[model samples]
Target chain A: MKVKLAKNYGFCFGVRRAIKLAESKPNGITLGPLIHNAKEIERLKENFNVVVNENIQEIPKDSEVIIRTHGIPKQDLELLKQKTKNITDATCPFVTKPQEICEKMSAEGYQIIIFGDEKHPEVKGVMSYCKNTPLVIEDLMALKNSKIQEKVALISQTTKNIESFLQIVDFLVRNCAECRVFNTICNATFDNQESARNLAKEVDIMIIVGGKNSSNTKQLYNISKEYCKDCYLIEDYLELRKSWFDGKKLCGVSAGASTPNWIIDKVVQDIEKL
Target chain B: MKVKLAKNYGFCFGVRRAIKLAESKPNGITLGPLIHNAKEIERLKENFNVVVNENIQEIPKDSEVIIRTHGIPKQDLELLKQKTKNITDATCPFVTKPQEICEKMSAEGYQIIIFGDEKHPEVKGVMSYCKNTPLVIEDLMALKNSKIQEKVALISQTTKNIESFLQIVDFLVRNCAECRVFNTICNATFDNQESARNLAKEVDIMIIVGGKNSSNTKQLYNISKEYCKDCYLIEDYLELRKSWFDGKKLCGVSAGASTPNWIIDKVVQDIEKL
Candidate 1:
């Protein structure tokens, strides 16, 4: 069996920068997982004594507080400022862009439309920047259910699919008299998904590596599944089955932005043995 | 021979208000023909001394200045303010709405889209209110060539056809990311077109009465011609040919908003004699 790797697989600039920041400060408490990959986060915890805590109250007063890659809400940032002087913001600049856009547009009295899953932490953080509650829609059809305002500005989360964002834009343009759109999908997410899609078509079996809870990893897995039927999303080499690769001639490997190089290399080495 | 009239025939609320305002002040020189009906304007000139002046510079200082129903630009209003102390603004409130929207939306950094003929007095007046040059497209196809902005606000001239306006709106909603649309079509135009459309199906010949230069009158004539082959647009009864009604079993008469009650009555009476 031949094992091929996607061009843009593994840790993105944002994730790498975040991990480096986390590693620089030993005994630091991250608000959440610094990066979505569990294995890399585990390595960080083992080597650097950095711990992930969902609640800020659990953090010790003297301990260094590191904001995660997804960034915290304005209210949380304010609380963090008052709680500790030792703070390292590992928040990705790509995620910070949409927050500023939402805040500026909302303050200008424009109704803000965000095209992203409301449950996602990045989307929640962006929405928190808006002074008023923005219309957060996951699907295009959901727009019909909301009361459309006369003046609107639209922005997307960093990891949102570009095609879906364009579809939403098309719908808004025809429905509203005036529409303003901002393409906020970061270069990392765009390149990763594009690379996975291109690689998926040339291979018989595809493997997507990252944390199961990671949204971007799930997106990569779904995109690969669109072109190749034998696509599996796994956290580690332990989840790999020998029987699935029995008849496959060419196998493709892709890792999410949060997934480290070590896990991807291990997965590829195991696929090569098949 | 049978003569029929559209349910909502002539002299709309705005036109009636303008005429009432014109009649209250005799010997008043209007900036333009008090309204778009030539015969009614002639009567105002002959009976009320309300002469139409193409240039405001011709008006005597301290003389009462009457602004037309299709309003003047901000610069002209200021010039008029400086020229005369006694001024009666006959600008229709419906026409004033779009101007205000253009001003406010442009001030808030939204690109304004006006759906109307660029050269038309009402559209020109509305366009003048925008701080930046607005995208004034006459048809849906014109929109395809223009660059669509993400944040937009759309308004229409009071007399634009609702169907064409909605088609333009449909295109905008699908093409723009965030669009803000305001339906600025006045009630008079809606009722007039609907009434004319209903009346045309039953008539053998259609007569659309108003000034030749009137945009709403041209729209009425166009709409009536679609349903009736023998539709004629006339400024007065002198332009009406008796031979056109020779074989017609039923005749329908509709007048534009600027057309007076007297012209419609005379046209209906002439058709009755056929």
Candidate 2:
């Protein structure tokens, strides 16, 4: 099977910036995984002595702590400020924009409507910025069931689908008296998804290379599955199966924003060997 | 042929309020046609001596002026205030909401986007409220071509199709950093259009009753034509034709927000006679 890479893939601006920031500060403790990719996290641990510590209470006082790209909650960040003097924030600017918008709009008395997964850390962080309680909805059903105020401010997760975000906007504008929407979806995510979708249409079998827990990677996988039924999502070359590529004439590869270039190259090399 | 009336049609809240206000103040000169329906305007003039004056400069000093339902330009209103103390604002609260939103949002440094015909009086009125130059787009192509700012405030004409308005909102949300959308489309307009759409599907022939210049009536006619090809837009019973009822098993009747019930009833009665 001949392998082709998606036009746009691998480390996005935010992930690349976060990695560089984390690499510069050796012996730093990240509040959470620096990025979603486990292999990259492991590499950081070995090469730069950067370790992931999920619990804020576990970190030693005055230790160098790097905030995750997803960012910590407002209260949690304040708590960390009190705990540590040496801190480096790695929160992506795309994520930070929503946080600021939520805070400002909420302060202005506009009810905030966050269109994202409630359990996602990024969403939790954005939610904390709202002075008033925000209605966090994952789907149209959740939005429909919730009671919305006349004046509303809508924000989306950076990795969410643009089509889904528009649907929420449409519903809110139709129902609410006033709706303020912040297009917080990262441009890199849109490019990756578009590339994956275009490549998936022409390929017989598709390989989505990224961390299993990565939101953008999962979205790519879901989008690719719509066009090509024979699709697989794997983290690294070791996870690739020869049986899956046996009869495939062409294979397409795509990676999430968090995915590193080296891992994608390795995956492609292994696929070629098959 | 069976003639059926749409569930919701004619004399929207704003029109009803304006008519009552105009009738109460007999011999009052309306700054412009109080409503879009010419027949209703004529009825007001004959019954209550409410005359329509298109030019603001022509009004005599200190004359009683009733503002049109569509509202007038900010400068025009200001000029009227300076000229006379006997000004009655008949501008619908729905229309007034967008004006206030545009003014407030513009004063706060957000670029305003008015989604309607540039030549429309309501749109002109809304545009005047913007402190900065507002982009008035009637279609998606215009919106795409325009150079938008980072922050935008969108308001639609009261009588525009909700679907078209939603499309503009969707595009603005995707492109702009911060988009404030005020759903200024009147509830009566929505109900009338929806009713017309529903009735159009079940009828062989659709009769849209309102003035030729009425925006909402044109929208109803356009929507009805999509489902029922045999659709006609007429001002009064005199405009109805017997040939239109030929071989039609079911006839649907709908009217614009500005259309009075009496006009709609006359059209339905004429259709029954045919």
Candidate 3:
């Protein structure tokens, strides 16, 4: 089988910066998983002695802490500050834009509507910035049941689909007296999805390499599955089956923002050998 | 023949208020046509001696001037103020909202996008309030060929259709970094269009009663024609032909914001006789 790779894939600017910041300081602890990739986190644990701690209270006093790229809630950050003065913030600039907008708009008396999964870490972080309780909707159906105020501001998760976000915006503008929209989806997500979609259209089988819990990876898998039927999402090369590649003439490979180049290279090499 | 009227039709609050204000001051020269309906303007001229003057410079010094409901340009308003202190501003509150938003958003360093006809008096009035030159687009195709800025504020004419205005909002929110949308479309336009559409769907023939130059009337006619094939737009009962009601058992009637109730009553009476 002829193997082809997407033009844009692997670690994005925010993920790379976070990884670099983590490596610079040894024996440090991250508030959460530094990035979505499990293999890279394991590598950092083994080489730099950086550990992931889910609970903020579990960390020892005066320990060096690094924030995750998705960011923590506003109150959590304040608590972390009281615990220790040494803190490294790895939150993405794109994600911070919505947080600031929410704080400002909410203070200006505009109701905030966040278009994303309420359980998602990024959405939880953004919601904490609002002065009033913000309405978080996953889709258009959720909005249909809710009563929106006269003035509302809308923001979306950084890794969400643009088409879906616009549908929510269209609904709000038609019903409300005033609507303010902030396009907070990052450029990396756009480029990665576009490249994966283009490559998937011309291939017989597609392989998406990323962590199972990664949001952008799932988005890529979903988009690729629409174009190519024989598609699989895996964390590493070991999950690939030789029989699946037997009848395929052309194979396409794509990865998410948190996916490291080494993992993608391993997957490509294993597919070639099959 | 059975004559049916729309549940919501005829003079809106703004038009009624303008007419009442004009009638209170007899012998006042209106800066422009007080409203879209020619018949109503003629009635005002004959009954109250209110004259329509299109040219601003031709008005004699210290003359009583009544502004049109759609409003004049910002510079024209300034000149009118200088020309005479005795002025009655009849500009609709719905139309004034966009003008205020344009001035505020423009001063805050945001580009303005007005979703309406460039030649329209309302749009022209709104554009003059913006500090920078604003872009006016009638449809989505016009926006496709133009380049939008990073930050944009969108406002629409009060009489525009809700669906078309929402489409422009969707497109701008998807492309721009920041978008502020003010839904300036009035409630009267929504009620009128909805009522006309509901009646047109069940009637055998539809009659849209309003002036040819009225924007809201044209919108009602377009929406009615979508559901009923035999639909006619007429200024008065005299324009209604007997052949239109030849085999039609039910006739639906709808009027624009500027249309007076007396004209609608005459049309209904004439339809019954046919």
**For this target, which candidate reaches the highest TM-score against the unseen true structure?**
2
lDDT pick, better of 2 and 3: 3
Cα-based lDDT at residue B114, candidate 2:
88
Each model's total of backbone clashes: 24, 0, 0
Error of 1 at B146 (Å): 6.3
Q: Give lDDT tens digits, candidate 2, residues B33-133.
A: 99998888999989989999988789999988999999999999898998899999999999998999888998999988888887888888888988999
Residue-level lDDT of model 2, residues A1-274, one tens digit each, is 6999999998999999999999999999999899999999999999999999999999999999999999889999999999998999999999999999999999999999998987888999999999999999988889999999999999999998888889899899999988888888899998998999999999999999999988889989999999999999999999887899777899999999999988998898888887
True contacts kept of each: 0.19, 1.00, 1.00
- In candidate 1, stretches whose alpha carbon ends up further than 4 angstroms from where it belongs are A1-20, A23-27, A35-51, A101-115, A130-274, B1-16, B33-49, B101-116, B130-274
For candidate 3, what is the total of clashing residue pairs? 0
lDDT-best of 1 and 2: 2
Cα error of candidate 3 at position B65, Å: 2.0
Q: What is the TM-score of chain B alone in each candidate?
A: 0.97, 0.97, 0.98
DockQ by candidate, in order: 0.13, 0.93, 0.81
TM-score of A-chain in each prediction? 0.97, 0.98, 0.97
Q: What CAPRI class is candidate 2?
A: high
Q: Compute the lDDT of residue B265 as modeled in candidate 3.
A: 95
- Estimated TM-score for each candidate: 0.65, 0.98, 0.93
RMSD of each: 7.0, 1.3, 2.3
